[model samples]
Target: MIEICKKYDCVGCGACISACNKRAIFMHPDSLGFLYPVIDQKRCVDCGLCVKSCFNNHKPTFIEPLKTCVGHVLKVEEQVTSTSGGLASVFMREIINNEGVVYGCSGENAHEVKHIRIENIDDVNKLKGSKYVQSFMGLTCNSVVQDLKANRTVLFIGTPCQVAGLKAYLKGKEYDNLFMVDFVCHGVPSQQILNDAIDAKVADNGNLRLVNRVKEGGKESKYTLRLLKEGKIAYDQAYPSMGYITGFLSGLYYRENCYQCQFARRERVSDITLGDFWDRHDDVKGLNNKKDGLSMIMVNTENGKKLMSMCKDSCELVEWDYEDFIKRNGQLKQPIRRHPKRDQFEELYCSKGFQSAIKESLRGDLNRIRKIILFNLIDSTLSTIPIIKIIYKQLKLIK
Candidate 1:
């Protein structure tokens, strides 16, 4: 059975649980809300499969990308629905068009999201954009195996650790029909924090059903965190929610393993790496500042290169330098630094609540204070002007 270490070990990957033929392994969450595999010793039979499937024990070597670029989908609908470049939609559609299955994380509700399989093109919409929560990976690796075993094409997208878990579960065997795409992940926050945030948003609107991190109809940079009640919109916030985003950026409630993400390096294990080209720079030529938002894609394998070639007909792409790509996407090279107030923040959260944690963390953070001040200043300045209101609404900044 896999040895679950207390600190810096389990990434909640769900590989070992799937690997057990005797159903001897299951996931158990600790106080931090991160799940770790717990082996049922009586049925384990000393088979050692669990240990073999653990990426925490065996790390994958990273390989330099063969090609890199920034791009977005040609379809207006897909471009608008996506969190950034809408590149994921193009990849999903490509696979679905070929009668293949694409696996990704999707929101079941505001409180929970898990990795799911999308076999039809219509279902891919649910998997679009970003749901800034750690998805439960329940037997997804096993499902991927079955799909590949039946000679079906499968495109799997997830965080780096998740991709590694799936690879490790396959026991180093390469599947010809399986295409893996992982992102330059920053970190995953605690599920409890997500639950708390959702509950707080819909205080009187009954229960929040939809929680989107990037709602449509805003400047790509200003996509809102939209929460819903019944079927109507309830909370539409921009940039960050104080409870979730503030605590997240301040390192309040993230899983312990996230602080030390081993996969944050150039030598990636997945076929393609996707991330937002956030810190826009002028040096990269041919990059349409779609400032609408662009996805930085790094092709890691021959399979990835082939896939990129197919994008010529479906995407607006530009070949860019790896250095330029890393300019804003530094998670490609380094792990997120732990916040100095992490311990205090979590303690306050575990004791007081999510809102309390956010308040405490935001204290003395002059940058956030300045942003709030500027926001109010802009609101007051814009609200009084009759013509400017029309122009701002036209710019999609009103809502």
Candidate 2:
């Protein structure tokens, strides 16, 4: 049996509840509008299968010498929309073209996360980009395993933990038909935070009629929440939605184990690891200025290499030397965690006892702004210094 706190670290990925052979763990929603795990100890044998299955406990072993880029690269020009790069769409398109099924996260009727199966090219839009929250994986792994058993090609995309969990659950099973892709994840945010932000937005407005079309305008445009009173844009405003970015950057959006993630090192379990290629070819003028978007595609296996090669004509592929890749991503040494002062702020929010605590924390608002300016200046200056470059490389252990 497993025990979990209702309000604390449980984002309820359901790995534990799903892993239990005795069916001891079940799902329950707390006050925060998110599901959490509830354990029935009487049926539990204490076999620890749940613990073993938890991605929190079991870290995947990464295999290296994975193929770099040997595929054709073309700049993808299509109407396809995605989180950053449209790589996932491209991958899905190829799979569908070949009559294969693509498995990925989709929002269900209740807006809950659920695994979806797409076989049509037009439906590929459903699975593109990062969802940035816990997805209800459902029994998709079981379905994928069944497909692989029948010699059908399956493309799976998800967070590292979800991928790891699938592989672990199907241990000793080998299938050539499976192609796994994991995001070079920062972390996922809690559903509560998302609900809170949405509620706050609704309250700011009069009615719950407006829906923000995040990707409608452009990538950089501030997200607008539009009020729809009878199928018309009643009121709209452009502002940063705290729910989306805050949970993403703070790692509170991730599973608790993700902070001490064992799979976050050089070697990764997935065939290909994809993420935002933040910096590439700084010495070359036009390459690094891609303010629009680009994918940092890392092929980690022969299968990944083959897929990339097959899709070469669809997208622009650039070969990044290992030294440059490390240098670009190395500055993010510590994964984002709860800020040190966040606990105190959370305490004040909970207790509602001391108004002074909030006042004290907010007293230096101007000073905080000044510090941010200075910090950005120092960061920009250091990034250019030759000596600092040497130190940065050394710190990342880049050869």
Candidate 3:
């Protein structure tokens, strides 16, 4: 019997499953709904392909970023609607116009997020924004390999572990046409938690048209759930009403591997890294106003520079200090510390469900509601009154 990695070390990227030719490997979910690869001893030939392709077994070397900058889509409407500066949308359009296939995460509703391929430019909208849940990567890596073998241009955008896993699955084959992108991930929660939250909150039996993270004036929100019911806003509340968002922001529960993620550091595994520039707009050189969205981009290779040059006209890019940039984005330096009560949260979740688990786990933090209100007040004040924003920044109160 061949073991890929320990249960806590597996990211469930499915590379081993795709690499196996004899169909000996299959993914089975644990009680917490996180997937892991299982090998069938009867069909195993021990070719070692599975181990060779597993990212956990052969850790890919990390590359320092060649260039770092802040950027955003030039179109106001696009920037306003995007999770950050709409750079991902620009990349998607560029790939589609060149007649390349783009693989990204999309779901019919909140509960079904998965990686899918899209070639048409119009369908790019499906891939926009972030899905808070861990995306299912079922056989998509094989699809990517097939496209690459046909001499077709391919752009894959996913979490860092997924990107590393796909490259591992390719067995050192080089593809000049392949462009890989990953983001500064805020560790993903399981599908079971998301499903339970939707079930508890969405009273109307109507289909969930969509689920989105709400932002205030393009600024990130810590506690908002914007679920659409039949194409209209249904739930727009914060914790303790939104238990999932509460747990997510609290860092109470995540996949076991996320706390020990090897890819969460300054050295990156992808050609390019994209994430929200959390610093104030004025702090960013190219962004003059403080209201709209902005994105932090780290170009890791020549291919990343090529991609950015191709997208030059679609967005504004300005140089930023790499050392200063990482200060705001801690994931660039280290993985999130494992919550002390993480195991307790999981145990409660298995028996009592999402709401009860979150409530009990966060019960000690009585100041949560107060802090949220204060943060919102500061956020609104900073957006509207410039003088107060300066004072708050000087006092080291808000960032």
Identify the candidate with maximal TM-score. 3
| Per-residue lDDT of model 3, residues 129-171, tens digit only | 7777788898888899999999889999999999999999998
Where does model 1 exceed 4 Å of error?
Answer: 1-7, 204-212, 215-218, 279-289, 366-399
Per-prediction tally of clashes:
2, 7, 0
Question: Which 10 successive residues of model 2 have the least lDDT summed?
Answer: 280-289
lDDT of 1 by residue, 13-89 (tens): 88888888898888877665777778788887878877888876676757799988878777766776677788888
Residue 234 C-alpha lDDT in model 1 = 80
Q: What is the C-alpha lDDT of each candidate?
A: 0.76, 0.57, 0.81
In angstroms, give how far residue 373 of model 3 lies from its true place. 6.1
Task: Please list all clashing residue pairs in model 3, or write none if there are none.
Answer: none
TM per candidate comes to 0.87, 0.71, 0.91
Worst 10 residues of 1 by lDDT: 279-288
lDDT-wise, the better of 1 and 2 is: 1
Q: Which residue runs of candidate 2 sit more than 4 Å off their true CA positions?
A: 1-24, 29-36, 41-52, 55-59, 69-80, 107-111, 203-244, 251-255, 279-291, 330-334, 345-399
